[model samples]
Target: MSSLPITREQILRVAELSRIALTEEEIEQYARELTHFVDMLSVLDTIDKDGVPPTVTLTFDPIAQRDDKLEPSLPRDEALAMGPVTSDGGFAVPKILGGEG
Candidate 1:
């Protein structure tokens, strides 16, 4: 069993560091939930996996990848014609990163 225990003070400290405002009820609830999570991890620590190979994925089959091939693309004018909005022979999209649209 793990000697370290999750406490309400720890939860409150974490909440404060994360700039999250929690009610007294919420603080108590999170303290219990976090403690349970740590207890579950302690249970995993009791399991013997010394000889087990670390698994990156559940499947044993080899991954299949499609062969990369050079393909002809549509002409610039034809491709631009398909766009909902086009400017200067290219598709024009709304600016998303706090820049001029």
Candidate 2:
């Protein structure tokens, strides 16, 4: 797949979606940067990878299992005492986007 060329409108839309208000100069600079990045990615997309298998590591026998050891955790009451607001043995945080309280 080919990378797309970014436009000013797209940048504005992205800024709106991200809830960031960008100045005119910043918008222009970001649009140019994004366009250049897409162009570079287009060049990368032309490389051949037909026979290559995707793997996280290049070395053989890279996987190893470690010995598991039991570790003592803080007492339940002590842990709960550190929380700002906890209930039912769990930390309770405020709603992230103001929906569920």
Candidate 3:
């Protein structure tokens, strides 16, 4: 439509913001497509949806949650023994960065 409002400059600005390089033809295509999409969305806004309820989820099943219960875990020494290096009752991994913190 002639009234559909996306300019070449606006399209270029959007492409710059998105870090994309669009050719002249692609830019024209996107400008037309985006304008059409926005027009469609505006048309949708005119529809009456007061009777419709907002949906959180469409699924019938309730979300399952695991029961929290205290259980015996592996002993500190036994767990630490599996590690390549154990210092001060903990696992020691190789230093990743040059810093002593």
What's each prediction's clash count?
0, 0, 0
lDDT of each: 0.85, 0.85, 0.86
* Weakest lDDT window of 10 consecutive positions for candidate 1: 1-10
Model 3 Cα shift for residue 45 (angstroms): 1.6
Q: Provide the lowest-lDDT 10-residue window in model 2.
A: 1-10
TM-scores for every candidate against the unseen true structure: 0.44, 0.48, 0.44
Per-residue alpha-carbon lDDT of model 2 for 1-101, expressed as tens digits? 43566788999999999999999999999998998888777876688989988876776875787669778879999989989899888999888886877
**For model 3, how does the per-residue alpha-carbon lDDT over 1-101 read when each residue is reduced to its tens digit?**
23458999999999999989999999999999989888777866777998899898787889776789888999999888889987999887777679663
User: Candidate 1 lDDT, tens digit per residue, 1-98?
Assistant: 65466788999899989989999999999988888788777877888989999887777788877679887889899888879999988889999779
Model 3 residue 1 CA deviation in Å: 9.1
Task: After the best TM-score superposition of candidate 2, give how far the Cα of residue 53 lies from its true spot, in angstroms.
Answer: 1.4
